[model samples]
Target: MFSFFESQRLLFYYLGFLAFALAVLTKGIAGLFFGPVILIYALINKKLIGLLKNPHTYISFLGMAVLVLGYYFGREALNPGYLEIVSFNELGGRFEENLGSKKFGYWYHLEGFKNYRFAPWLLLALLALPLAYYSKDDKLRKLTTLSTLAVLVHFFVISSSSTKQPWYDLPMYPFLAMLASIPLWILYSALQKVNLYSFALSGKIIAFLLLVVVFRAPYQEVWDATYKPSEPPWNYETMGSEHFLFNVLYGKDNLDKAKVLHLGNNDHLRFYKKVLAQKGIEVELIEPENLQSGDVIVTCQAEIQSLLNENYRLELLNDSSVYRKYRILSANRKSPIDHR
Candidate 1:
């Protein structure tokens, strides 16, 4: 959008406003920062007055407002308090309070660049900024200025927020990558000059090698996360229990009649319950006092021990480290309970 505005592409500028509206819908208020970013660019370029006088700017603003407000208002009408929830929980709370246990200082995201979160690219991007800003090409300098402004504005806004999450830094990566590309292209061009015993490698060969070196770690990381089978513990007990439930629900003998009960509350259990529901399995929450014969229970080791101490006989089905599955056989009422 900034590029289009810079190049005086009026049609694309209007379309960019609509695109910005979609971005806001997809990412909540984080997308609103783009407006301030562009305004800052206009001010820096001394085009603020011209931009304000442009009637298409007002028309574009109206279009964007209609698209964004239509969805928000429609949702609020259907679900009362939706706007309040979004404003308070999603936006306002993040700015005013620490919402999670894993809180970090303001420099958290900035430190991530050194800690392999952005890595290699972020360092190179920082190095390229000065060169990009002072480039002989007018277009390059303009773009560098705009991108630098965006990165600075976004960084400050997110870093100043009281609540922080790793994924919240996602939007900044694209602009950083744009900055990084200048140095990468320069390196690729330099690589093209390499000679081995009077033999010159083609630009294509250099580019291919450069790409392989650049992408290898990220590619391997993606492959390991998605396709590779995870080892125990890292597989997470909740995930293992999800697999166990899948097998039981679709077993050859068809234990479809078995009552599946989740015996305790945990973050993982709550999250995977939704995952299990998506696969057509329903897990009911059951208290220890409600234990009944033939009920298939899913719980942690401590809860299982508590059940055993209460004289409830259970046949262990599967144990996934922290979590376990068991079938209640009987409760021996006459037996003395072990307080220990």
Candidate 2:
């Protein structure tokens, strides 16, 4: 039983489930890369350790795991596409092309760009700092430096051409560890050089500062935003999709004034539309046969949700959850709302 849990295949399979949860809860990218990238890194590192005779092989594995997991959960994500880098909204819409072309989405229309916030800058800073701080103790300073630079260069170059996301930056975490390991590692090369007992003050101070920095404002936001719903119509606190959609579809003065569509698939679409009807919002649930040419679609991240191409454009939207309402749905916003 213990071995099964520890087995790479089993571990990755479980983590892949987590990725699915993540994909549904927030963005699909987390679930997409979480297991795959970590498994790949473990395999690569394990191979390297096997080629050499070192007493610290197990210790190195532990350290690498810690580093990778830390970066995976702690550091900023390198998400792909404009949604990670911008804000977009879809009011009472399931899907719509040219509805708001500038809105951040996965597919590129003839439209140019939309919101470009500080996410990119923040991600770069995250990759450079603490990793370097932690790696300061390593002995392979130069090798680590060159190697890290190479990795960073590749990451930046590859990402530069394509769209960007917070998770996309994850590929660079390993490299940053390489750079960060240089300083402290040289000092701790052996117990005799300075001894682990020495420089207790600096370690505590750095650790405290790191804890503060790493667990600062973003951590709070992540905790809050992670568990809480980001928008209204969908309770950030509860399963609000049904309530939200119903209200949007038939909530007195809302349906008539709004153009909406469920981008991917929500089996509950009919259920929610029924709720809307009960609330006096008259709406027509649709299939491809019923689709209008210029219908507006309200899209959210729907993991593995299937839909007919003729029914909706399959537009994916990110979250711009304002208050209790899920305001906008970018292609990247996996809100667990689409239960197709």
Candidate 3:
């Protein structure tokens, strides 16, 4: 949308403003990247002077401010203490989560790029940086520079945080794809000049095959090994050791806006909290000793027998080898606590 505005599309400028506002509503601080992306785009286009004078640019900033305040106040209205919880969870809680985990902070992405996971796709995109830097075409050079700079800016900002996750970088994917396509088309055009049909077709086929080998094969292998027929919604046991129950509770269960009594450690608890929130359901983590009647227990496989012995009618919700989800059918049903 910012690109559209840069190209003098007035309608898209407003649309982009609305789009970024919606993004802010959905993802909070994550959606604020458009401000920097637009600044970088204007800088690359040498229109920073005009940028300062543009009424539409100021409107964009106004729209963003409105969105930020509206989202903050709206959450406060909804829960009163929501922002306090958000601050603690987003900052202190997240920092604690990263204490011992060694999954690269913000630089994990660089490792993926360097490892050639996507090979020519990644390599081609990277090659565009230098090509764009040295290109004679003004428009192409500015756009590519904007893409590169936007990605770098996003990376630098996100990396400053102690916590990093794969999904956090989604905003950067489009720019990376844009960068990769530059060299890709350049190579195709070069091949076209060398051999209009024969070599071009062969090169295309080879490139396609290489992508299949480098990118698709590993993903397909993992999918085939984990996917299950009975569990139509989710692949069993593939969602981490602690997430199996979480997956079934949020994925397969049909209870409308159901509340979940989670009997487990706090590991991956936030993910389930978010998922349940989307479903308009509440999730509470409770101790095993505090178990009550009619309270469904979501726990690892080892706890199933103990739950059964406590006279809770066990309805197996998930039965994967790694983890399980079970429901306690009757609060009134009484039997031996250790019949198992």
Candidate 4:
């Protein structure tokens, strides 16, 4: 499994840096998703399918997969900057985020902090437990159970964000998917030797999972958010090639510019600005305190008024909060804050 680990090393570093930076800056452990990300890193490097064939190859492949997949998945698209726009504009709603993380790590936060949005992640992790414990293959069982618990805890904790930002859970998805895949692969391998009854059952179960993965609802927001280049098409500058968030939102191009205040890694807002600048529109990256009326200030629900001057009006943009209050609010300069 040295090869697997070899591949995941970069991923680990990339995610590690991201988690550390986010934790320090956000004053929260929204970075907890990194643990699952690491677990997935271990699995991918080891090469799940290959390791299953020969337990000896397990460790190496696990390492490799984690590295490979982690590198691939650890893009800026998964960060809070893109996630906020993407979550509201596309993908699942804020119901799944753990608010507790807003104040601290998910577990350390208050009660009922985590809400909806557990798309079989917890179930799959839990299911893998018994399989790993009972597996005929000792090596696989240990890895499976270990990985399963990692993902389960990751999901349970990260989901508690009082402020549910989509990217907060980004680190866990790859690990969750990989962890779930292992048990099925093991089950199939085992059933191949057993009678057709169990084999058929395994087949059915695997097929069902395939359906869940494949047929899940599309992120219409993203598809609809796609737009082509023009005299900057619309007026504002949109950085970043291919709207990761936009794609998840409209499922196509909406072709509009957001005067966003981005607070993320590598200055995510700044990252997008470079690209949009190419298109002739320089996007502004401001902090909440820099928030101004009439300007579309994009930030977490909690941070909205943190930068607000109270002179402008709050319009509904998106609401992914624990209380499910105002998620994405717009401060309109047209009307008085008190009047509206």
Candidate 5:
């Protein structure tokens, strides 16, 4: 980012600084590396002290420091244990627990590289780096080399972490795209040299082909969206089936006046509560054993048999391979005998 904006207008330099601040705010520690990344770029360009002496650099750092420190203090003030968790428990053993093991950290990142089912694309993108670094074009070589270096740094940092997820590599996509385009440039140059057509016409064709290759996945996705049935709203981002469950309810009943309850974690319950809150409908999450008279509970098929023995009425609402939605009737507290 700094490289792109360094030689631009004065406004662009400040804009670059703002971009760095925003990155840190949104991405946390991942974005913090931008500070060192830019500094290294300055050193590579033989402007190390020149960058440090620049007032904009200091302003950017000051802004980010204030934002981060203020957030820390605010969180600590709100919850006394927040500081302790942030300092020790937040990422300490948490990643290992979530990831299951640290041995596959590098493999997990490699697997994530083919997120869109295009493994070869990433391999080709990597191959472009050396070519870009050694190119005859001074501007292209320098910019590509810098971008590739930044991506490598990001990759190593993220891969070293105990936790991993596919979208964690999003920051490297732009550099990958730039690197991927090297082959097209080479193809274009070869075509122009062959004199098959005017240089201008050949260049236009190559540009169009490059764009087509770049946008192929989007084109395929658009086609799928046009013809495919509406898919279940199972989002990995939230790691929940709340949206699908809600939509199932939406089809058969009015949520505004419905009695709703969920049997799950606080995070999942919060999703249900937020959706039902404005309508003055309170959704309660109850223990399976504490099944009371007139209690409505949401649970899956696996627990239905156990609930049945306790005299809870079950109505199947929606069924999926992974999760089955059911409306559990209240337990008959008057009699200990099973109704089913």
Candidate 6:
């Protein structure tokens, strides 16, 4: 995008359109903001008329349409109603109603900046905006305008939607980082003007130290999140147990022939099913009454005791905090020893 802004070559325009199409393909309609952002920037800079007169712009748009719409057309051809399902379930449904009860106010993303992850850079970005806007440099002003537009456009669009996730705010970070660099650059330039050798050296040292101070918190956050993640507050042991169970069964003998029954409500059942399917394993949801000899049951702790009370002899295979894996040794028969 920066390259396109610097050079209005037809090749750059094509590359930009291709990139826009790829972004949309990768993340769905969230990527459509690219067009509106560029259009708005051109209008703000009084370049709309010029862009309209440029023939290559239309050619680029046509190419992008073929690339993006072709995929949608092929998908719809293969599975009729695919686009309709996506329109309702993945696109418009998110805006019209809260899916999965993930409702949050419009200020959710805006408030997220106050969190530890973004707070440090966000402050610098905010301070840099005014300085960048009033600067005499033409290129700096344009870059700042573009970054600001991208941030605002993406922020409002996602924030207004009923369905929200933390990752939805990811697209805004690059632009915010771009904006944040302006203030750092200004400080570096100011420090370079110190007249005395000692003062200049001291100023450079101070600037370097300030840069380190500003980056320390976010860097540590990245390190901890990647290498030494702390446990989430929510109870995720059941889900973790499912993953552990799958890992244990992944290479076991006759896994493909095993009748695996998942009991109780598990929200990620579909995802886990797909993952297991790739490993030649099939899992089904079954009730406690459906227990049969030789059947394997993956259930939570709440259901284990009741199965045992029903006179089903279950052999414990593995256990996690809230989930258990068991094989039915005998169904509708009492065992001499308590299995629980």
TM-score, per-candidate, Cα-based: 0.74, 0.31, 0.60, 0.34, 0.67, 0.72
Worst 10 residues of 5 by lDDT: 253-262
lDDT of each candidate versus the true structure: 0.72, 0.41, 0.64, 0.47, 0.60, 0.73
Candidate 1, residues 223-305, lDDT tens digits: the string is 99889745457544335445545455465223344443443444555564566677776656555556667777765445445
Instruction: Give the per-residue Cα lDDT of candidate 1 at 163.
Output: 84
Ordered list by lDDT, greatest first: 6, 1, 3, 5, 4, 2
Residue-wise lDDT of candidate 2 within 195-264, one digit each (tens)?
2457656555555555476447767878888897345443332333444474475432244322334434
Badly placed stretches (over 4 Å) of model 3 are 87-106, 116-120, 134-136, 193-340
Prediction 6 TM-score vs. true: 0.72
Clash list (residue pairs), candidate 3: 125-180
Runs of candidate 2 with Cα error greater than 4 angstroms are 1-143, 156-170, 173-206, 231-243, 246-260, 263-284, 287-340
For every model shown, the clashing-pair count is 0, 60, 1, 67, 0, 0
Clashing pairs in 5: none
Cα error of candidate 2 at position 194, Å: 14
**Candidate 2 TM-score, true structure as reference:** 0.31
- Model 4 spans > 4 angstroms off: 1-101, 104-117, 148-175, 190-340
lDDT (0-100) at residue 78 of candidate 2? 50
The regions of model 1 sitting more than 4 angstroms off are 99-102, 193-201, 229-238, 246-289, 293-296, 300-318, 321-323, 326-340
lDDT tens digits, residue span 1-340, model 5: 5444446465667677667667655765566654666667777878788767878778866876787778878888998888677555335644444554435646576566767534657766776767766678877776776677777777776676777666667787777777777766766666545534455576567656766876798688789889873444543223324544465346533333223333444576466667765556555554455555444444443434454545666666545543344555555456554323
User: What is the C-alpha local distance difference test score of candidate 1?
Assistant: 0.72
- The C-alpha local distance difference test score for the whole of candidate 4 amounts to 0.47
Residue 142 error for model 2, in Å? 5.6
Q: Among all windows of ten consecutive residues in candidate 1, which has the lowest summed lDDT? A: 252-261
Best by lDDT: 6
Better structure of 3 and 4 per lDDT: 3
Superposed on all Cα atoms, model 6 deviates from the true structure by an RMSD in Å of: 6.5
